[model samples]
Target: MLLEVRDLHVEFHTRDGVAQAVNGVSYGVEAGETLAVLGESGSGKSVTAQAVMGILDMPPGRITGGEVVFRGRDLLRLKEDERRRIRGAEMAMIFQDALSSLNPVLSVGDQLGEMFTVHRGMSRKDARAKAVELMDRVRIPAARERVRQYPHQFSGGMRQRIMIAMALALEPALIIADEPTTALDVTVQAQVMELLAELQREYRMGLILITHDLGVVADVADRIAVMYAGRIVESAPVHDIYKAPAHPYTRGLLDSIPRLDQKGRELYAIKGLPPNLMHIPPGCAFHPRCPLARDVCRTHEPPLYEVSGTRGSACHFWTECLNG
Candidate 1:
């Protein structure tokens, strides 16, 4: 396995009280496979990625429990120096906003080359050469000239490509991309996702694609994990989940997407807002908004139960959900 997370829980200690962000989320990804985590905002998708990267803030956010095992090693147990050494070379992440995630003062080439210099101890001259090569690999036009340009000089899509190039620079065993194509045109989104798919094939790396846009991930993801209120409510192969969603929330998400085939029909939408993290509801977190919610769903949390071989759901009426 390239990565394994078991019973992960993350909490934040605000002045108000503790906010239970991620609760007992578990998933794994092997080399060359892609696991797309799909959920609306505040579903703990980005928080999970931050935890995996060991970048969660300590005073406010705390990893209450869990284990992040990567390549037979538990990342949570690694020393600071040890983890730092492995971060860029063994595991890398692409943040949501490349505009803010990238430093403005530095030229794009220097930023990309820093990874090589820090991890591989390459000289500035050699690293700059490698940076130009990376830019070309991501299909950035005018690689040599663009290398000297700052982050502010690139378009949203081009800036995103730069981020991808940096993430893949070391050929890390795993890459955690948090909405890599955000704020891009539809055409650019397609291009960025395709580039990621091609790069993953070449590197044989495990990928955790965190996004709310199921449309972007439909083609690349092997498995999909549906998260709600910090927990994974359902998980299965992408095809199985889309074809036969066992959880009400999963069904609701799929229904929300507009379809060309259903031309005259009103677009389906899940009612109500996502529960607040600071003051989440008891029991199954999705209970309040779930169409098929039962009395048990209100007060008694449902554990993820096997709906079929290798597929699971947190709903009380998994069999009935299939009929929906």
Candidate 2:
């Protein structure tokens, strides 16, 4: 495995209470494979990614337990400096908002070049050349001219491309892209996803794609891990998930996707909001909104039942769910 997040737990200390952001979540990605972490906002998807990247705010947030194992090494046990070395050189993250993630005052070239200069110890001139090469590699036209442009000078999709270029600068073994297509038009979203998929294939790097939109991941993800509240409710190959979801939460998400055949009909939406993390439901976090939820769901928490060698569902009535 390129990256294995084993039983990860993260908590945030807010004025209201301790937010159980990530509760014993576990997943892994191998080189040349794409794992899509699917969920709604505040489902702990981004928080988990931040913890793996070692960028979570410590005072307000803490990892109570877990092992972020990367290539046989436990990252949580490493020193700050050791983890810093691995961040950009070994693994990288592409944040959701490119505009905010990029430096507003700095030229894109300087920003991209910083990766090379800091990690590879290249001279400024050499790093700038490499930056242009990266931009061109990601299919950003007129890279030589745009390299010196500021983030504000580019369009939304273009800025996102620059972000992708920065993340790919070092050819990290793994990349976590959090909602990379958010706020873009459908056409541009498709382009960005294609670019990412192409680069991942060329580099044969493991990819963790975090997104709430199921449609965006349908074509790109090799496997799907659906999260609710802080836990993974269902995990399986992408085709299996789309064909037959084995958890109520996963079914709700799939049903919520807009279908052209149902254009005239009312769109389906999941009932009830996601539970408050600080006071998540006693048993299954999704029970409040689960149509199939039963008395057993309100008391005893269900263990992840193995549906197959490659599949699991954290629902007591997973068999019933699969039949439907």
Candidate 3:
């Protein structure tokens, strides 16, 4: 495994109350493999990624428990300086919003070059050349000319590509992309995703793709983990989850996808809003919205039951769900 997150728990302390952001979330990604994390907003997808990257805002956020093992080492045990060394060199992240993430004052070249200058101790002249190389690698048109442009100069899709380029600049072993395709039109989204997949294949890097778009996950992910209220409710190979979702929440998500065959039919939507982390419901966090929820579901949290060697579901009636 290139990365393994075991029994992870993260909490956010707030004036209102302590919010359990990530509760025992566990998953792994092998080198060259893509693991897609699917969930609605506030499902802890991004928070988990932030924790893994060691970039969570610590004043409000704290990793209460769990081991984030990367390349045989527990990152949680590493010192701040040590973790910082590994963050971009060994494992990098592509944020959701490129515009906000990129420094407004810095030119694209300066921003990308900073990684080389800081990590590799390269001179400014050498770093600029490396920056141009990265832009070209990510297929940014007129890389030499565009390298000096500001982030505001690039289009949304191009800016996203630049984010991917920066993450790949150091040739990390793993990459965590949190909604890399957000805000782009459908065509642009497809282009960005395809480019990412191609780059991952070329680099053979482990990839953790976090998004709520089922269509995008279907196209790029090798395996899928469904999260609800900070917990992983189901995990399976991408195709298997699409063919037969074993948990009500996963099934609801699959059903909610717009089908080409059902053009005129009303869309299926999961009824209730996601539970607030600070006041997450007892038992199964999804019990209130689950169509297959029973008394057992309301009274006791279901453990992730092994459905197969490579699949697991956290629903009391997973068999019924799979069959249905």
Q: List RMSD in Å for every model shown.
A: 1.2, 1.0, 0.9
Task: Report the lDDT tens digits of candidate 1 across residue range 134-192.
Answer: 99999999999999999999999899999999999998999999988867888998898
State the lDDT at 99 in candidate 1: 95
Ranking by lDDT: 3, 2, 1
Query: How close to the true structure is residue 213 of candidate 1, measured as C-alpha lDDT?
Result: 87
State the displacement of the C-alpha of residue 62, model 2, in Å, after optimal TM-score superposition.
0.6
Residue pairs with backbone atoms closer than 3 Å in model 3 (clashes): none
Task: Give the per-residue lDDT digits (tens) of candidate 2, residues 131-222.
Answer: 99999998999999999999999998999999899999999999999999987888999899999999999999999999998887798999
**lDDT per model vs. reference:** 0.92, 0.93, 0.95
Measured by lDDT, the strongest candidate is 3
User: In model 3, where do residues sit more than 4 Å from their true spots?
Assistant: none
Give model 2's TM-score versus the native structure: 0.98
Q: Please estimate how well model 3 matches the true structure, expressed as its whole-model Cα lDDT.
A: 0.95
Local lDDT at 137 for model 1 = 98
